[model samples]
Target: MLVLLPPSETKHPGGDGPPLDLGALSTPELTGVRTELVEALVELAGDVPGARAALGVSARQDGEIARNAELRTSATLPVLDRYTGVLYDALDVASLTRAQRARADARLAVGSALFGLVRGGDRIPAYRLSAGSALPGLPTLRAIWRPALEPVLAAEPGLVVDLRSGAYAALAPVAGAVTVQVLSERPDGTRSVVSHFNKATKGRLARLLATTTGEPADVVGLRRLLRRAGLHVEHAGGTALTLVEPAI
Candidate 1:
């Protein structure tokens, strides 16, 4: 199975690897658009005030524009290693066993606003861009990405589990991909969709799948695996799984 994850707004700065190489990313088809976006971002960075306005950032986030300026020259890290926050903190890739790490490298890819999609082992630099951002002198990211990215996702073999947030998911729609929703289950049997815990649950699930010996190939198998892992899971029909978290 292939798992699709969203990119984090915050990234761990610097890396031990080589600089960013468009050709080295997972989807070669994305290089053209990546190049375009990179050029626009670099150009926009030349004008700090303009860049801040376009990126929707305040004075405190001015450093992000500088990060964009040095995108190519900066150090690089493995795709998963670069992104950090609630979801990635829960995934905690650094703590995984070697075998689990290998599995994660083979099975996971991240949805990026700048690079399109990158596999776990792909090396990338810290850059500032979001699925919702509209770069100066460029078409909307959705417009630029959909044409090239959608075909690449559709062509992938095996079942896909998409864990991207709303904006990133709009960048490319994966055909036949299963989606997951995390819900808080209360004593009265009512449920509410969780935000922070939703990401954490998905991260934990990603880790479990990465380490498992028997990988699931479809929604049914995924549901079974999640249940076996002690999750209160329910098959929500049509390629959707609800991981019910007990109310706190």
Candidate 2:
């Protein structure tokens, strides 16, 4: 008989509010956090040597691919124009070498970690974190939000952006408070995980979305936007909205 494991849940303690008290975090502590995050990302890549190359694809490029595919296959254009800019920028910088690609990957990994931490209600000094300097014309790791987040926002405008840094800061956050559940699906089945965010963070994100798109950051509005962009929105648990797609 095949054994099935129970659904697993992990909750990270939320961080404090902004002007984040890094006082308790020593240099070594920060370094340790960064190192651990990088290692975890590398492991997540799961690309064994001589197996397959990890393209270190930029989030911006990924967003572009999604947007372009929508344009070709769907009847309407993406309601969010920023997606086009991100896609073009990603295409322009796709020729970097492996070493440069690694740097970009590192930034992306770190940026993701920061975002996760903030979403969990931690007070993070986003600018202080060493995501490294911007690569001139190249898109930064924060661009991941476009592809990873925009679809979700388009589906559930109620979801909020807690902390925005790097390229993400330029985009507005969505309004309202909503729960986010990240899920991983394998050959066997699917598993879901929950993400934590405080009310303040939700407010910040909603304000960003409202400002950027000139649209109300609500579930109905987001769903309309996403559907117009040729994306499918899945509503689960009545309140949770998920954007269905292949692993990012």
Candidate 3:
């Protein structure tokens, strides 16, 4: 199974791995797009004001632009280790056993505004970009990504669990992938879509899937896998799964 995860705005800086190498990443079809976007980012980074405006960041966040400037040369880490936030914090990859980590390296992939797509084991550098950002001299990111990303993702052989956030998901919609909705159940029995908690739940779910001994063949099998991991999952409909968590 392929688990598509969303990239985090925040990352753990500096890595022991070599610099970013697009050729080495999975989904070679995205190489051209990734190179184009990276070049745009590096060029824009030359103009602090332009970069800040394009990236939707404040003056204090100019450091992010600097990071973008060094995208190609910066030391790198596995994509899973590079990103950090609610979802990644919950995934807690650092704590996984060797076997579980190996499984994670095999099954996980991250959706990126910069790289287009990256596998868990793919080494990447700290860079600043968002799926919503419209870089100068480029069409809408979604437009640039869809044509390139969709076909690559569509070619995946088995069940795909897409946990990308809205904007990243829009970058490339997986035709029949199972999408998850995280809901927090209240004491009164009402459930509401969660934001912060949603990421955490998805992270936990990804960890579980990564560690599972057997790959799930279909949605039913996926439900069984998650259930075995102690998560409350319900089939919402075709290509949809609702994960209910206690009110937080």
Candidate 4:
């Protein structure tokens, strides 16, 4: 299965890996646009205030812009290690076993504003960008990404599980991709959620799927996989599942 996760706004800086190399990334189809976006980012970084406004960052986050400026030369880390937040904290890449880590490298991919898409094992620098941002010389991310990204994702080998946040998902939506919604069960029989629970649950679910020995052939198989893992997964209509948890 191909499971796509969302990139985090916050990231772990610096890395031991070599500098960014577009040709070496897994999805070679994205290299052209990746190069374009990367160059755009580096150029924009020359103007701190303009970049701050364009990237939705603040004065205190100037270091983030500096990261963009040095994107081509900065040391890199695996995409999974580069991103950090509640979701990534739950995935906890450092704690996974060797076998599990290998599995994760194969099954996990991330939706990105800069790279378009990246696999778990892809080495990349820490840079700042968001799905909602509009760079000065480029079109909307959705426009720049849709035509190029859609075909590449549509060609995936098996079931596609998309766990990206709304904006990233809109960047290049997969046709009939299996998706999950995390919900909370309140005492009043109402369903709602805080984003914290939603992201954490998805991260844990990604870890479970990554480590599982059996591959899910379809959405039915995917749901079975979740259910067998002890998650409260229920059908929530076509191409979607709802994972219900107690209200936070």
Candidate 5:
């Protein structure tokens, strides 16, 4: 199965890999849009204030704008290693066994506003675009990405678990892709979507699915696996699966 993750707004700085190369990324079909978005970002970087407004970043994050300016020439890191935030922290890739890591490398990928879809091993420089950010001189990111990215995701052969947030998911909605929602069940029998902690929960769940020996062919198997892992899972209709955790 191909497990799709959302790109973290935060990233770890610096890497030893060569500079960004659009052609070197996985999903070669996306190179055209990738180049377009990357060039647009680089061009936008020329005006730091303009870029700051466009990217919705504070003056304190001017350094991030610099990262965008240097995207093409900057050193790169593997897609998985580059993104750093609560979700990635919970994924805890550093502790995985070698074989598990291999499984992760093969099964994991991230949805990016700047790069579209990047596999775990794809090396890319740090970039600051978010799914909601509107780059000047281009169509909405949804318009730019949906036509190019949706089909690529739609074509994946195995089960696809999309762990992206709603904005990111709008860039491309894979047909038949299984979506997961984390909810917390209360003692009073009330339930609601968990916010902050669920990203970490999703991370741990993604790690579980990626490292395990068996692959889930469909949503049924996927739910079975999550249940086996001691999660309280239930079908939320259509292609959606809900994971319930006890309320804190």
Candidate 6:
């Protein structure tokens, strides 16, 4: 039987600092508090089953504490990025101090477990194979790119393109914006590009256009349009969009 503990205050034994006055701190500060709590819980729980059970209870209690702290720190966190719509608070990892980074890493592990639960049984495929290389198969490769585009395209009605120059470009007609960036490369010397749609490229005949655009420009809308147009959109990242017929 699973036993859940009631929320309670358990002071940090080290007394590093009073339960992180998150209300007075920044998002980075709140992240630090969260990291500390995770570390303390992990230490307390150790490797025993009983410790694991206790840690679960501690996590639930601390999550509420962290949320409350975040509310106080919300004013300090940056606003969501205009293009991607991903919350700046969620992406504030780079601003954390080294100690904070360690703590954040532990919290991230917990968060990953939560994501796994919400995804049901679908495991994020291991991109690297046993031979220290990317796994073979076009279908798997396509799957990798789909998720990367889904969230971004859903938030902004545009195409994400990976350019040959090893940069990513996000084009949006609504904001009249085009951003290009270079993504990291794999050990095997493969680079990726991601481009979004804008007025300049919207009417162009392109594979990504065939796969991701329609009259309205949203991903779901474009998907329906692609189906009606009898086009198959594969998941080969930039390669898929590059293959479409050129615009006249």
Evaluated with TM-score, which candidate comes out highest? Answer: 4
- Those runs of model 5 whose alpha carbons end farther than 4 Å from true positions after fitting are none
Q: What is the C-alpha RMSD of each candidate to the true structure, in Å?
A: 1.0, 19.2, 1.0, 0.9, 1.0, 18.7
lDDT of candidate 6 over 1-248, digit per residue (tens): 00001111221122112232323322232233334333443343343344334323344444433432232122221111111111212234445556644433322210111010001111121110111112222223223333443343344334332221211111111122222232334466554432332222321222223223134333344345545666443323322332222222
TM-score of each: 0.97, 0.25, 0.97, 0.98, 0.97, 0.18
lDDT of residue 65 for candidate 1? 93
After superposing candidate 6 on the true structure, give the runs of residues whose Cα lies further than 4 Å from its correct spot.
Answer: 1-30, 54-219, 225-248
lDDT of 2 by residue, 1-248 (tens): 00001111111122233323423322222443434333333343343221122222354334322322222122321111111222223222245455543332222111232232222112332211123323223344345334443333344323332223323433323334333333434455664432322222222232223323334355566556646655445655443555443232
Candidate 4's C-alpha runs over 4 A off are: none
For candidate 1, give the lDDT of residue 44: 92
Instruction: Give the lDDT of residue 25 in candidate 5.
Output: 95
Consecutive 10-residue window with the lowest summed lDDT within model 1: 208-217
Q: Is candidate 4 or candidate 5 better by lDDT?
A: 4
Which residue runs does candidate 3 get wrong by more than 4 Å?
Answer: none
Relative to the true structure, candidate 2 reaches a TM of 0.25
Candidate 4's residue-wise lDDT over 1-248, tens digit each?
Answer: 89999999999999999999999998898999999999999999999999999999999999999999999999999999999999999998899999999999999999999999899999999999999998997899999999999999999999999999999999999998999999989989899877998999989988988889999988899988888988899995689998998886
TM-score of 4: 0.98
Model 1, runs deviating above 4 Å: none
**Each prediction's Cα lDDT score?**
0.89, 0.31, 0.91, 0.93, 0.91, 0.26
Q: Which lDDT tens digits does candidate 1 get at residues 1-248?
A: 88999999899999999888888787788899989988889899999999999888988999999999998798999988999999999999999889899999888899999899899999998888989898877889999999999999999998899999989999999877999889988999999987888889889988887778887789999888888889988785899888898888
In terms of lDDT, the poorest run of 10 residues in model 3 is 228-237
Query: lDDT at 62 for candidate 3?
Result: 88
How far out, in Å, is residue 19 in model 2? 16
lDDT of 5 at 15: 93
In candidate 5, the residue pairs with backbone N, CA or C atoms under 3 Å apart (3 or more residues apart, or in different chains) clash, namely: none
